[model samples]
Target: MDCASRKFYHKHEFDCRDFLEKYCADKPDMEFAEDALQFPTMSFHYVFSSGFVKGDVLIDISMGPLIHHLYSACDIFKDIIILKLNEGCNMETSRWANTRTGAFEWRHTSAYVSKLEGKSAQIQDKEMKLKEAISHIICCDFENENITHPVVLPLADCITSIWILDAISKDEDEYMKNLEKVSKLLRPGGHLILIAALNTTFFMTGGERIYILKHDANFVINALSKVGFVIEYYAVQMRRNDSTLIDYEGVMFFTFRKTK
Candidate 1:
């Protein structure tokens, strides 16, 4: 599909459950599991464990209701605030956070994270801690001056945005604008952890072709510099599965600090 013909992610209703099944499920045979699940899980574990980003409040701006990456952050950050672009994501995330019936099962992912910490037996405990740490899940508009308008939030110590910019931005300028907006949520010298799919044009989710901004590592570095963020650490996980669902070369993880 052409760029103009492709579906804009923020304009349509997202099938959160379908997205979880396609990418976040624990099935070993799932084609994009390595790129979508294991990479972020491992990266977040390492970032948090290394004490590279210290903070009490963590603001998460992600594409959908994916929470597997936050398991590690919840152990370190006392207050976890999630900002979603749509109410569907909010409800879906709330279902899991509240442990309501029909919520998508995440025990398998949690078990993997626990094993990484060498405390596999504390899976349930980890889940409970995450649930409690998540103080709020608010719907937001990145274009607005106050992304979380009508409910002001204190500047966050750390912010983690995973794959949202790639899926939502229509071009490089919009991506930079979105990045700048997200950076405003962090205090000076605070950290921003970004995980992006490299050189991706689009992704297939819920039988729909969603547009993803195509950009390389250099472009991202330049954008961050323009937004006053300095990269502290960088890592990339090369694509392990030749999945036709997404046209991504690899996934890049960056730990950046706001310089001003």
Candidate 2:
């Protein structure tokens, strides 16, 4: 029986957001480390994404399991820059995001990893191995309604994000505007890397259907090109399986450079 096809398995009792929310509620403690698997969702993301290394900078918006896994896997850069939306701040209300250590435990899998992977300085150990340090974004409000030029990101040499742009904006102009704002903190020749999902739809979860937009890789690529990003490296389907996924959307990964 094919799970991807209907009639093969149990009806989905939950929607994506419901699962996302519930994952936070049920397992508050384990959400951080398990998220590392997100990188391999596509074929190329794992191969190309050079996780935190010395002298590098990054910003993660809509902090998810991926970032936590990353913090564990590689020492990204000298100055680790983080960016999160309004959702990132509220730890108590929001499930796994603990501002205290900048780790997200919202997903049960992630929460589970947070605790079991004890005696961590795993982050520091990886950083020591990679030779780097972490730096906080100065503004602390990447979600501000107030937009300005040169969006300030301290110690930023480059930026990296995973599936955040389409997740945040349904309105095209607003989405483009936000990316432009994010660009201000980056210096010329800086890179912007992403692990993204392709065309998708409203998924039903805990009890509600969440409206998610499908993004055409070309559309995103065109948008980035318009915004001073020179496409450097792009890999589709970064070597991970969704064999268990029931007719879900596909994933795309990219690496771009700031030419302006």
True lDDT of residue 79, candidate 2: 55
What TM-score should be assigned to candidate 2?
Answer: 0.60
Candidate 1's C-alpha lDDT?
Answer: 0.89
| Best model number under lDDT | 1
lDDT of 2 by residue, 1-260 (tens): 12233210012222333344433334434231122243332222243344422235655443332344334323345455455443323232223222335334334333333334453334334323322343343223434643222454453466666655655555577668768866776777777766666674443444444444456779788989898987777756422334322123565667778888
- The sequence of per-residue lDDT tens digits that candidate 1 reaches over residues 164-256 is 988888888888887878888899999999899889988877888888899988888899999898999899998998878889999999899
**Which lDDT values do the candidates have, in the order given?**
0.89, 0.47
Pairs of colliding residues, candidate 1: none
TM-score of each: 0.97, 0.60
